[model samples]
Target: MKHLTRLATAALMTTSLATFAQAGGHANWTSVADQSSIAFGSIKKDTVGEVHHFEDVIGTVSEAGELAVSIQLGSVETYIDIRNERMIEHVFRAADAKATLAGEVDMEELDALGVGETTLTDFEGVLSLGGLEADIEAELLVARLSEDRVLVTTANMIMLSTADLGIDAGIDTLMKLAKLPGITRVTPVTVRMVFEK
Candidate 1:
């Protein structure tokens, strides 16, 4: 009985250590290089555009191929303030949607991404917006900035329609003012997520 008890205790300790190693917690993002230069283009316009990068990145990682990414939502920059405000307030409803671009990536199939080299992969995760949880899947180009750091990017991709989330596109006002085509489609949003150690 004594020997059995000692063995059980040893097994428990080993399990605890493995769990700690697996759940590697969050890391700080010290710097984001080439902010104004990082070109992020939307699928709707399909033209090369620019975006402001994260001033501070935070997230966690796990051994079971889990990657939690949290980005600052208000930091988006497409070289226009009016467009930004319209998106955050009118389109995205920032008041209702306070989520700061957080999501997780499961990359068990790819094993690992190389540092400083972008590799293509597919990811599926939840995108919370305007009190809605949208399941998103897209092809992504990922590169490791450092050992515990990564950059995830997608270009010219549709981010689902506002109607898909049961939200009005506010196209009536836009069409009347700009004299442009009605908003049958929502604009594609391009994103570059950078995570640092």
Candidate 2:
């Protein structure tokens, strides 16, 4: 689940966050896309569950702790190619659409964290998709892996509903097209994000 550990990290950094900017210069961390990931789980027929993920995720953090993240809806990987395509067209329903997050954290605290140290905190962020936005909060474990590298992950799994994402219609369409009798509206998500100075 190391890979899936990244799925909800998006929920971690995107929320109602403090806003500020550094005065003189901005120390920032750029997302390491290859090293980061996001994973989500879905239940169908009330019992059959599967885990899926997004292959492309990116974000940035500024000196002032401003964080912005993007998860390409088209990059969803469902293990099955046809299902992936179905999700893209029927569920996501957009070309080049992206789920984005915006919020702020305690950059000053993170800056002071020594390598090999970890901190736990709760954060709230706004996750926007399909023109709908929902407020989300996440408990996170942030570890300073190196002087210039940090690993951010969810301390607990997060729940997100299709309605919250404005994707309920798309989910309905997906079930109808596949002749699926049932699919759960709420999904559990986890995330892991890597940032480097």
Candidate 3:
């Protein structure tokens, strides 16, 4: 009976390891640079709004339900050369800077998605920007685009306060420098991320 119990224990351990490996393998995917994008919008003078693009962003979904994204703060394209320079100096405050976001996902749920299937789910993540971190919540639409590719997009816009991100001082500077009457303190952000195995 002791020997039989030992054999049963070994079998259970093996089964658990296999289940873990399969979940990790199914969740592992890397961001496709040319196909993935993250964007945010700003409002200045209370009425003029513009969308800004992050040209260099990369992310990955890892084993055991971890997702991470990093963006080069200097890669922001504001459609104006001097404005870009000003933003880098004033808002971002560093020549070499990076903003990172990390989120947790359900490994089993992600693995269960089949090709061409889509689902809307609640997402919560930490956004680290301008030397501070803030909790962000959003509704995400996750779609399995192909056997090797998955697409995730924001179903609802994420609104963030500059004060919470420690970037308000810089935006204040920009408003004064640009002689703008006012700029909105809250910004709306959205993302379209594509990942491949």
Most lDDT-accurate candidate: 2
Residues 1-197 of candidate 2: C-alpha lDDT, one tens digit per residue = 21122233454442212111111126666767788767888878888888888887777666666777777777888898888887878777764767778777655544456778777777777777667677778787777777666677778888766666666777778788879898887777777777776
Residues 1-197 of candidate 1: C-alpha lDDT, one tens digit per residue: 11111111111212222222222223323223442112222222334333322222333444553444333434444456665555445544462333322334444433344555556665555544446555555565555655655555553353455454434554344334445444444434344444444
RMSD of 1: 14.5
Better of 1 and 3 by lDDT: 3
Over 45-157, each residue of candidate 3 has an lDDT whose tens digit, in order, gives: 67787877777776666565566666777777879988888888888877577777676665575567687887776666676665567676666677777777777776766
Q: Once superposed on the true structure, which residue ranges of model 1 sit more than 4 Å away at CA?
A: 1-85, 94-97, 100-104, 107-118, 177-179
Range of the 10 consecutive residues with the lowest summed lDDT in candidate 2? 15-24
Q: Which residue runs of candidate 2 sit more than 4 Å off their true CA positions?
A: 1-26
- Displacement of the residue 156 alpha carbon in candidate 3, Å: 1.1
Per-model TM-score, in order, reads: 0.55, 0.87, 0.84
Relative to the unseen true structure, what is the C-alpha lDDT of residue 44 in candidate 2, on a scale of 0 to 100?
82
Q: What do the candidate models score in CA lDDT, each in turn? A: 0.38, 0.65, 0.61
TM-score of 3: 0.84
Q: How many backbone clashes does candidate 2 have?
A: 18
Kindly report which residue pairs in candidate 3 clash with one another: none
Model 1 TM-score is 0.55
**Which candidate model has the greater TM-score, 1 or 2?**
2
